[model samples]
Target: MTLYETIFTRRSVRQYDQVQLEASVLAEIRQAIDNEKQLPGQNARFEIVNADRLKGVAAPHAILAYSAGTDAALANIGYTLQGVDLHLQNSGYGSLWMGMGKPIEQSADYRILLAFGKTSAPLRAGQGDFKRKSATEISNEDNAIARVARLAPSAVNFQPWKLDFSPGKVVVRPDGGGIRKLLTGNLQKIDLGIILKCVELALEREGKAVTALTPKGGGKTFAVEVAFE
Candidate 1:
């Protein structure tokens, strides 16, 4: 399946077979990560490591994300790596976004990790298998983009963002009050980026040319605009 199709069937896979992937497979994974486009004006770095280099994670491999602490940087990591998350699962591997996992070696810019490896777990049957808020609750308009984009995962399953659709573009903004206090870390910003990838992929599948992924604002005002034609 393509990344967009994978979105409907993907899940946060926890159980793994614990076998390290072959060098060729890991190379392909790295190639995908290296080629993932970042949001304009943001630079995020990703590193692939083995199980021995990590703590608090069971997967045999991981991709460590490093970036500045700014809201745009965090969201760029989310938006970019989410494509890797989908690609891994779409290729029959398992993946999970790990907030608590860490690298044995520390770096000042380290932000988060995506744990992935071979697994026996099954992919979700489809969108029906997702336990998420209804379209009416998460989007201003009920449509295909909202349906696929709402499946984008968030920290603690908070789903703390909403979508507003307009001609040739869609704007995503924080959904409810008290999100910052409730989600102490900046994971919510990353969630915005992740969903932005979903929106972009859905648009591409519909034959729309995505002209830009514009991330703006900070604090309670954070938002992302996906422009297409």
Candidate 2:
């Protein structure tokens, strides 16, 4: 399946089968991470933890633990990780981002985890199941991208975000009213990355394209300038 198809078809999987990952599958994942690290402006490092070691460390079944060299490094981390997430989904692996809290450690760097494995059974969660505000609710009637932005995920399913459309841009801002400050720190940034994945995929499926700008300054708000080529 295509990446966009996987976005619509994928659902969060919380359970997994006992089978171990295939050698080829493991290689592909490692290769993808390696390639992403070589991309320009990327400083994040990804390490594949052994499932047994993970269990020993009280980690999830299969994890890609990522850490950035600095705070400014997170934007590149966000973009690259989203690509990794979508690639895994398209390859038929069940994956979810774990962002509630980081495990206590001596390390001072920022960390995010991606868990992957085969689903033990059919996914119990519904795909595209969340209720989204109508186009009129979030933007002008002609704003088609708002429909896709509504599909983005937030911490604990809060969906705390709003979109504003102008002549050629779509602004994404978080609604702090619904977000719990401590429970999710910097997670919303990762969630925004996921939303960007959905919007890009959805727009491409419709034969549309847009330029995504790197988020500037820290706050709940960010913008993606979408213009026709």
Candidate 3:
């Protein structure tokens, strides 16, 4: 399946068949990580490690996703690794993002771990299988990009992004206020990264030239504006 197709059909898998991937497959996964695009100004790293090296998950293999620990690092980690998550599903493997899994002191640099292996959990049959917010709920206009962004996974499914679209650009910012803001502020950035990734993929599929993302005007929360070239 194509990566774009996997975007709609992939599901986060928890139970995995306890078999290690072949060396060639593992090498390909590592190479894919090496080629993943980076969000500007964010430094992220990834390494394949034994599942036992992580404290809270069971899988034949786990990837230690690490970053420079900058303010945008967590969100960037989400942006970077979401591609791998899609790729694994496209490759017929199952993957789950473990936000709470502890890396067994292999390094303090680890930010998140992804557990992946074989599994019998069925691939989601279609886009309809996704239980996500509607496009209207996440954006000003209910367009194709917004439809895809609405399906982006977030911490507890908070889906904390509000999008504004223009003729040649897209601007994304945080959504929610009051207690929800206080509770999900930091996590919302990571959620935005995931949404940004969805937008990028959707735009690319539409033959739009995605430019480098730049920061928007001043606000306590982070915002990004992406222009189509």
Question: How many steric overlaps are in each model, in order?
Answer: 0, 0, 0
Residue lDDT tens for model 1, 158-205: 887899999998998866567554654678778888888898898888
Q: Model 2 compared with the native: what TM-score? A: 0.76
| RMSD of every prediction | 1.3, 3.8, 2.0
Lowest summed lDDT over 10 consecutive residues: which window, candidate 3?
213-222
TM-score of each: 0.96, 0.76, 0.91
Please identify which of the two predictions, 2 or 3, would achieve the higher TM-score against the true structure.
Answer: 3
What is candidate 2's lDDT per residue for 79-119, written digit by digit as tens? 56666766776676777666642444435664676767776
Looking at model 3, residue 49 earns an lDDT score of: 80
For this target, which candidate reaches the highest lDDT against the unseen true structure? 1
Model 3, residue 68: displacement in angstroms?
A: 2.9
Residue clash pairs of candidate 2 = none
User: Compared with the true structure, what per-residue lDDT tens digits does model 3 show for residues 1-229?
Assistant: 7777788888889898888889999999999888888788877888898776777887789888877655467667778888888898998999988767777786777767788999999999988888888999888899988888787777667777889998899988877567876776556666777788888888888889897777554335667788886
Off by over 4 Å in 3: 176-185, 216-219
Residue 201's lDDT in candidate 2 = 59
Q: In angstroms, give how far residue 202 of model 1 lies from its true place.
A: 1.0
